[model samples]
Target: MSRVATRPVTLPNGLQLQTGERCVADLGRMVDPTVYKNPEQFDGYRFVRMRGTPGLDAQAHLVSTSPEHIGFGHGKHACPGRFFAGNELKIALAHIIMKYDWQLTPGYKHRWEEYGFGWSSDGMAKLLMKRRDSPEMDIDNF
Candidate 1:
């Protein structure tokens, strides 16, 4: 969280204020309908579409965090390890998908808990996976 303050002043709204600590929250801006289409729905391809543009492509990558995405932060303050983290995630996901057949356990449901400033899921769902290298997978097929 970033802290900011305003010098003593009053104007348009006639609201008065003195210099004080302010916690700037960016999540609301991230999902604002004015800034994003279908803000309430998850669009995995949002950045992918933006990447089609020339200049924007450079900043649309997962690790290139900006004001539009504070997950890794923005500018020089952005997380330096984001590149390594993104690559590791991709490699892990690729290996998992290539090596196993998996599914969530029956009757499982997703749930999240709201903390003061964030939300977290317990991820209680169980996954049943089987190796894909068994007799069911014919080696000669490749």
Candidate 2:
């Protein structure tokens, strides 16, 4: 017999699920233009600007569990590692930015590919990177 995962419930988006059924939140819809300016365009500082937002707090770091940030999972099933993972990501990215110059490979066009309920980076996309001779600040020093 199959295990019943949950009781019937209605999601915020108005979708209903019966007992034992499963569903993944549609995060893409949350970031649509209705919720963000020029949502289709890339803005690296988007989260930076969003940090400390009254409701979002530090979750703008990009991984957290909430009704609107369910990508990190939800409720008791929510990812326990999200906080550590987010900090680890920040440290890694800081090192990359301070120790190297990077950019997309010139003339290489990239596009996101959507499959079913998710999207993936183009397999052919390329990035160019070169280590800096002198770093802006040593990350390990403090």
Residue-wise C-alpha lDDT for candidate 2, range 4-105, written one tens digit per residue: 438988768797889888665467655678666787678988778878578656557677556545667768878889878889989999999899999999
lDDT tens string, model 1, 35-55?
677866779998898899776
Error of 2 at 36 (Å): 2.5
lDDT of each: 0.73, 0.75
Top-scoring candidate (lDDT): 2
Please provide TM-scores, in order, for all candidate models, with all chains considered together. Answer: 0.64, 0.69
Question: Which residue runs does candidate 1 get wrong by more than 4 Å?
Answer: 1-25, 134-142
The TM-score obtained by model 2 is 0.69
Q: How accurate is candidate 2 locally (lDDT)?
A: 0.75
TM-score of 1: 0.64
